[model samples]
Target: MTTSLVDAESVLAIEIGSIHTRALLFDVVDGQYRFIGAGRAPTTIHAPFFDISEGIHLAISHLQEITSRILLEESRLILPGKADGSGVDQVVLTYTAGQPLRVVVMGLLEDVSVESARRLAASAHTIITEAIGLNDRRPPEAQIDALLRARPDLIILSGGTDQGASRSIAKNVDLLTFALQIIPREKRPEVIYAGNHALVTPVKDVLSTYTQVHVAPNLRPEIDVENLSPAQDILADAEFHIRSRQIGGLQSYRSILAVEPLSAPFAFARMIRFLSRINNPGKGVIGVDLGAGNLIIASAFQGNSAVSVLPMGTGPGMAQALRTIPISEISRWLPIHIPESVVEDYLWHKTLHPTLLPVTTETAAVEQAAIRQVLWNGLNQHRTRYPNTPLLAEPILAAGMPLTQWSPQTSLMLLVDGLQPFGITTFVQDAHGLTAALGIISTNNAILPVQVIESNAFVNLGTVIVPLSNARYGTSILKVKVEYEAGNQISLEVRQGSVTALPIQTGQTARVHLQPLRPITIDPIGKDTTRSFKVIGGVCGVIVDARGRPLSLPTDAARRRDMLKKWAAGFGA
Candidate 1:
């Protein structure tokens, strides 16, 4: 006997950000999941409403008006759908508005278990205020003082293998317990033990009296292996629990969710992992979200994934982001001449008023410059964390207001100049900022993500071909021929140190053949060989960049402006 299975016919996913609350509707159409519609409203976590539910209801009301569907009944979400097709079958929520968890990591070895714990913290939206290791040369009194001053929300105690050392682990636990005793009971940090399993009971006994105690699998069970999923999961659960308790209306919001709300960064990371596993073999997927106060960079290869959350962004965190890179680094991307002081002032003003959009071309240019720096910082952090991961060669998904608010040309240029990937790569933007929403729904039901992604949830920005070479300027880098339907053909020569774009509408496909000149590499396999491959068109069409590896930009004032103008014209920017 065979059993029949049915998928949820209708679903509503909501994402509450620091400034905006967005809702997306998906329904099964013709036996496939499809994105129905989306609506957004200013987040009401603060000010007049002071209730997140208000913003969610308003956003859903907008969706109801758009689709003529009744999602809310008496200020409550209608669940399991209605016989009249007026409700949804399920609802999921994700958020990124609350303060990041303040965490302190304690480990035995600085490079061993300590490093693994640090990587786990990096995977979530957290601020590592202090990390204590056994190698510290400071006196125990001073160390305890620093730990007490940090005032962490949680403590991650990890050291020792499954059956390794117990004496040293007890010593570290003793120190942590003493520190917790000094603090008030209501203010003590929760403890998560991810150390030797054999000592979990003893460790809990020592710390449980001071605060809540949770246990996870050892982060470094063996010296040769680093198991982070267990720790990552526990950390995310703890963060949600703490956030729901601290935020004013989130506790009530939690009661309505079918499942616990997930952090935006965690959900986004999972979505990237799922996409990387399903699509693209032997490569990885990179998803970047540049929020007002945070930047999330998630990469997934096969089934392994890593997320790096940088606390600096365009709004509340802009001042810190500015200190990381020099003013000249951002000014180089601006086509027009702007003084460093003026650029600095613009960033300061933006930090004060993040919702303000660029009103003029000059301001727009400055905004894009800041975006480039943010992307650079995100990519740099990814590289530092996962040095051996493959290049961002697969489809790249970009989110956040900066990319969505700007024209496709300008957004694409900013990405290209910042990442500078070689070979063939496809770039796409999260058209409706549904990455986190889709990710949460996908976790509950696997078929939903495939359905929504197939329904054109993302806007394809086209494929780019960048040849890696260091040939002299003005030299012929490669000869390209593009053949489409009806025997139409376009043949052109791209020069070294130049950026060129070819027009191709979205949903169009072309057969591209490349013949590289001597000492020039078109494909990643061989530098001096000819290559042929099929390419897809997008809103920004096809861009062929032969601007040698390291992507040199002219330093002289006059020449730099001329070069910028030429590149901008090529991309219709």
Candidate 2:
């Protein structure tokens, strides 16, 4: 019986995240795996000794209770094994890291080489601790002092290409050797060199003599393009391995599985590639996933792309919202009048104690504020990072658990407002809060997650022909027209960070074009060109030509709120 139980068909895939621990039960039905039941518990990361198992066990215990109840209540007519309710088979546990892994970049130069290393570190979700270089004005003692303060988990020593310059690279090696003298052996960070391959042996001789050193292919073997895959893989391996050793509880067991620092972003990117490449190779799409600790932004245009993670999350933003912004700011969205200090205290407590339930009316109000602040912060960060990138032109798909709880109006408002800040007009969401879970599904079972995301998870915000030239704050330059079939046309002026509502009903198509105020077209990198293209609507609408810099809307609190109100009124939002 015990052996038979091990081979049972039902299985549970568990994901333990910094904010939430979830259990997803899967069972075979009609020769296909179907979702059974899911249970969630708030994660306890700051608890004594950081025992991850305590949280995992609690999550699983709830799952068992929920599944048993579901079977007893409903399985009699719908599922097999109704008598014993022996449907669950196995468990696969995965986790989202709580503490961010740090990486110190030791490059040959400050601007060129260090910049490339910084980009790679950003993509891998590694917090950069130190950026040391040969020409850097800082002394070796200052550099070492900085590294010691950071206490990074790993160091990425990168420089010149395969057969390129070696003097600058050697300087970095010498500096690292000096730093190693003061740092203890056990506490010393791991070093990864992605530089001139020829200097790898010498670097090992100097640096590896004191610390554990690994080598990967040069990040920029040539001047034009960079090859960071091998280095990225090595970094991920080192992060997970080191984290597994120090973090107690479930992480120790979970580290055995293949995990990456950008696991969620990578999962989303793979899904898009699988879908687009399989059917149409010339596909361009975008994906965004917002969570408690981080917000992931990924985009693919003309088959190649970049994905990034932002550190600002809803919980922290909400807590800070009270002190930084006005409580009346949040209450404006709420129906009833709530005290400022009450809301502030509620948000603060929620940030410090995320797992607790909102037991009172004020607490609920604070939750709304926190949730709104979270979405707002993410959009703000995206706009700041990719200032040249226009949001309204591209369909930005957002997936998150909070989106599931929001009323459609509130959700729509948040989505529209968030995008309005960046000029993102169109929106998509997994209303069921299933995108992250589906990410795991796409990994284990192919094609299914894509189908589900396409069919149920994503929603089209709307289509509008946003001229590139008019993609600036306070500039309403180009005119937009959606020509419907019955000689009907809807027109609106282009406004940054605002969505125009045309009465084009669902399931109907319209022709969209941008009558640019200036002769303009936008390149794939979002730069304005002296050329123009016919308007097209897909994930991202046509990249119209624009003259001025990308929208530089104000971030001043009052000014922004006023601008937001005006834009919201433009769409009757």
Candidate 3:
């Protein structure tokens, strides 16, 4: 993902979401890529304005106003920025158009070929409606019935390896061909064959009789090796067309873009690959973008990642979340006892007025409660897709307007409550929501995302330390001495079930000494026996969460509310 730009000096990226559309400008500053300016507007993709270009124009025009440099004339962008800096050198697109594409996956084995196919389909913006492998016990009739019942928009068939036996692969393709005949040609779903290179011709020749078939590279060319990028590229194109037609056709907005728009969720999921690749040893990266209509959960370790895009969120999709998240789960996070009916009513009202603000303090608390559960639910789904990332993630990032409404401290508390990260971790906020734009555009210019990441483009929310201990609540487990850059020192004795922030501020550096009284896991290395290290401070400074792993919140509602308060107060939230 690291490549230097040659001709392009100024680049403009447009990010379209369900509720908003953003335009971000990046240029070489002091011989390095840096985010220069940005503009945003309410997305006009529905109702009174069906053309996506309206929002694009508004955001770009706003960018022109901010930079005093014109990027558009009439409805088109001025490419190859002039010496006067009145335009940009290139333009790119990224957007979260709508729902995740429903897909049915079939392969030779559930854990091998089928699992690889499912990963290709499970981008942040895709949902696998059904998965059938040779291991599946259902009869041939039942398999066909299940495929039809799924009502998928796409079917991905993958099995076998390069030059491997083709009997099972051929059998799956034959079954898929039969299933397509069951549905009318007009209603038949598109198909993707990413199995053995040897079987592509036969699979395409058979499935192409019903609907368009795309032959992607073999997803599993070797038994022990896995590669999905080639197939993921095809999926991205399918997603683009699948979503573009839903909002005033793809060509309607094509003129405003220098290139075709990339799927936002997939771009974000792929971005984790870059993040996880650059991270320090022994830690992974986890990121969640909770938007009004969608939620993206992605975690990556050593370039392997799990990403899921749920079609619901805190705004327009609040009520829809109830389908996956239990009603009881949401109320448990509330600080005050509120009837389940009241919470249900809140979800309905939020769905109607997605941008509605809290009317009272109680309403505000309830809204936070719902958001916490939505994040928790998103993580739960992500865990199911890939569970090998890491027990603790470094720089766990939280993105979306829902989190921006709260202070960094409050957001960190929500992260602790929602993610329940283990061991040691750091947290940051994608405050400007430029992650999708940066991630997708990296395909064109990789320097942009890396440079922007190193810059203060993201808000650092401080590091969190969670020690593994079985000591009872209120018992001291870890001792810490925080020495700030300003020559100030503060010592703390953290007890079980406590969450607190040490004395430090953003941009400050600190050398910390740690002593564990109980059995705790802190990676040990080097010559010194002392567990001391230098750390950077965020808005909330260094955070210590002594809460038990698999976090045990109080069973009683009243006690849980009190515990939440004490935790919040510890950060001065």
Candidate 4:
């Protein structure tokens, strides 16, 4: 078994989305890991071919042609390579195409355990069909009726402190058992007991007799403290178990997978946690995976982490986003003055032709405009659900179809104008979907993730500096100075409500200094009146977003359009 980064000479990572399945290849060059090539094919989990392995094989076929490497042996993969050179040493997989998991949460109290269960559901793309608790006004029989009506795929039973309750939990469990008996034996939802530790065996014994039972650590160890990571792990496992069977296609490739297949959103969230642990501990790390149908916002701060999976994205899977983000809101991000009706028509047309690439600049701009709105909507969802999780983070990472489909500068500006994050941070793009792959690979080979991440496996969008102040619009806000490694130096000033970029190419390094003109804070900590740091070059150099904290666009349509254009020009998009 490969236990370290150096042991693997070739790696193949696959991410299967609803619309597309992408195969990315990474290999060692001069004793260091590098992204070699990638291939894409339409996902075949639906319609005429219900097997996803067909899509996976086709993608790898393209990868073979691209690199002139033999990766397949007829119908099966050529694993562990051959002495004559044809195949990979390891293969990893992630997917985001399964049906959303439906859940029924039952707790002792409404605000304590029940709320925590809801948060757990929010961590993944799950629907809470019913929330039952001791505080529930309905009678026990009515609660049972509700649970059976919901027909949840999984039931989360959480309540009481570590050793607080026995009788109350038993009462709920007895009621749950009766409800399970009511449903057909094959239709019973799997149970997850995350309540008092003392009842673990009893809960499992009774529930396992009816259906599968998963035990997780107490979600609420104490009244004031909430522990969720372990429960989240169980949730992800249960989701994988439930969806793997639902898809049917995964069964064919399940035996050959290097590790257990992981849901793309859950894998992406785990990746964010790993990245956050290694990143700035005080600020936090936020990563977004905007897939074809769903978008996930994963944030980790200090020791706490939050994940929100929303039904929002670029093309075909935008029904939920449209309900919230109006045509005018999308138009606000467009540089051209297209009418709201026209913009809506374009989006509807794109939704129908989800795979069609934009041929005209107008259509592309409209698509990007909609993308900004989706990003904005996702950010708002994160803030609303997990307010305690800080948005001030370093290296805001973006992934999924939108990032890969658009230019780097376009992705950067959409993130800036949509997320509107404050303080100084770096912007990174996961165009290859390596973040999830690395996270999954780290489960077995811990060193591979660190080495590959430090290598050129991801794109560097550059450092983003946002100044916060109470200065009037158009007033000078911050002064920047850059001292290049070769001894060249320059300084500039930026006014409030505007954006600008510094000339720092990729693979270059410089020492940067900043001073707020009107006593603004550039870093997460408010005390830094002056700041200096060594920075690296990226696709877009140092960005000074003097656009202030709560980026507000002009009320007039034309004015907002021009302002959006100015920001795009600033990034040279």
lDDT of 1 at 93: 86
Write model 2 residue lDDT over 1-573, tens digit each, in one string. Answer: 223212235545667677777766665444444565677776666666376666655666676687773432232212233436553433455456565667788787676567667766765445687777777788778887888888887888888977999988877787788778888888888888888888988888888788878788888887655775566556656655666655576555554333232345555544444433443233344566666556666655544555566664555434434555566555544333566667666666666765566667556545655555555655565445434333333445667665545544345556544443232234555554455555555555554454444453355444433344444544666666667666777776654444455445545656654565543343334443413222223332222222233333454656654654554444443
Alpha-carbon RMSD, candidate 2: 7.4
Over all chains combined, what TM-score does candidate 2 have?
Answer: 0.71
Give the candidate number with the greatest lDDT.
1
Over the stretch 441-519, how does candidate 3's per-residue lDDT look in tens digits? 7886777788889998888988887766788899988899988777879888989889878777787889988888887
Q: What is the lDDT of residue 422 in candidate 1?
A: 64
Each model's total of backbone clashes = 0, 9, 1, 0
Residue 129 lDDT, candidate 3, scale 0-100: 91
lDDT of each: 0.83, 0.57, 0.80, 0.82
Return the clash pairs for model 1, or none. Answer: none
Candidate 1: where are CA atoms >4 Å away?
A: 1-8, 47-50, 523-530
Better of 3 and 4 by lDDT: 4
How much is the lDDT of residue 545 in candidate 3?
81
Off by over 4 Å in 4: 1-5, 302-304, 524-526
Cα deviation of 316, candidate 3, in Å? 4.0
What TM-score would every model get versus the actual structure?
0.95, 0.71, 0.90, 0.94
> Which whole-number lDDT from 0 to 100 does residue 314 have in model 4?
66
Tens digit of per-residue lDDT, candidate 4, span 1-573: 335437656778887878888888877666666778898898888888887877898899888899898898976678888877688888888888766788899998888899888888888777788998887888888888898899899999999898898898998899899998899987788888899998898889998888989999999989888888899888888887787777757756667678888877777877788887888776889998887678889988764678898878766667667877777778887788777888888777766777778788888888888887888888887888777767578879998877667788878888887788888888899877788777777777766677778977788888888878789988988788889998999999888887888878887899988876887877655555548888898888778888876778889878888888888999878
Candidates ranked by lDDT: 1, 4, 3, 2
Clashes of 2: 9
